[model samples]
Target: MLKTAILVSAMGAGLMVATVASAADAALGQKTFETTCVACHGAKGVSVVPIYPNLAGQKEQYLVEQLKAFHDGTRVNPIMQPMAAALSDADIANVAAYLSSLKPE
Candidate 1:
């Protein structure tokens, strides 16, 4: 029983760490956007160009999926593919979180 209790505690701790590691940091996302995405996506995710889709207030999961697709070559866009190629999974999550958190204009 004592061993079982210890095992459960260890499992809980591990799960917590995993959750924290996977959680997106919106602050980091904003910085990345400013440096990498602001040119096309805009500061608050509203695109100034009619051709660029506005990202503000979009569903976080959808953004993540699309970004992943772009990164993986499943989605083809000459511009997006190259831009997304540099983003890691965590960066993608962060960017999605930041964009989704915005209120669209």
Candidate 2:
């Protein structure tokens, strides 16, 4: 019984560590946006060109899935494929969070 409790506690702590390790930091995301995405998708995730989609006010999960698609090569856009390739999963999440947090202008 005591061993079961100890094992459960250890598992819970491991899960917590994994969760924190995977968490995204939006501050880092802002830098990433300026460096990589702001050209096509503007500073606030709006696109000046009609061909480009505006990302401001997009849902976080939707943005994450789109990034995943690009990263996985499931979606094919020359710019996005390369950009996504360079991003880690946390980067994708952070960027998604940043975009979603923005108000549409």
Candidate 3:
């Protein structure tokens, strides 16, 4: 009983942290998307190009990892490489939150 309660509490705390982080970064993400990402990714994460994957409905952690890779030049998208390299960790996280929340088309 005690263990279960502790586990539940920990999970709840983690969710709270994630929500707070997402909320704080959501606005910044919208701005970044308008300037940098929308050209390829499209508004609300729906991509017009078949080669460009839809980011909506992707796991948040997966999105974050991919963004980090792009920023570090580990992932090679011709147009994205330089832009990703310029993004801060907060930008990546916030953008992930905003995009991931969109419904996949």
Candidate 4:
């Protein structure tokens, strides 16, 4: 019973840490977007060019899947394939979360 209590406490602490880390990831994503994505996607995930699709308010899961697809060559885009290749799974998730959190016009 003592061991069970200890395990439960440890699990709760781990969950808290995970939540904090996930929050940090969104911040990182925001920074990444400002530096890398703003050139095309604009500061708020709206595209400046008609050719580029706006990213704001999209579903997080949809962005994640599309990014993963670009990274994996399942989706073909000369620009995105190379860009997404540089992103890790965590970066992809973070960026998706940040973009999806924005309001669309």
* Per-model lDDT: 0.92, 0.87, 0.81, 0.86
Q: How well does candidate 2 score on lDDT at residue 105? A: 85
RMSD of each: 4.7, 4.2, 4.0, 5.0
Candidate 4 lDDT by residue in tens digits, 10-86: 99999986675456367778888787788888878999899999999998778888999999999999988988898
lDDT (Cα) of model 3: 0.81
Write candidate 2's Cα lDDT for 1-105 as tens digits.
999999999999999855754576777878888888999998789999888899999987788889999999999999789989999888888888788889998
Candidate 1 clashes: the total is 0
Clashes of each: 0, 0, 0, 0
Q: Quick one: ranking by TM-score, best first?
A: 1, 2, 4, 3
Instruction: Summarize candidate 3's per-residue lDDT along 32-102 as a digit string, tens digits.
Output: 87788887887788889888778876777788889889889889888778888988888888888777777
Candidate 1 accuracy as lDDT: 0.92
| Pairs in steric clash, model 4 | none
Between candidates 1 and 2, the one scoring higher on TM-score is 1
Model 4 residue 7 CA deviation in Å: 25
Best by lDDT: 1
What is the lDDT, from 0 to 100, of the residue 56 in candidate 4? 92
* Candidate 1: 10-residue stretch with minimal lDDT: 15-24
Clashing pairs in 1: none
State which candidate, 1 or 2, has the greater lDDT. Answer: 1
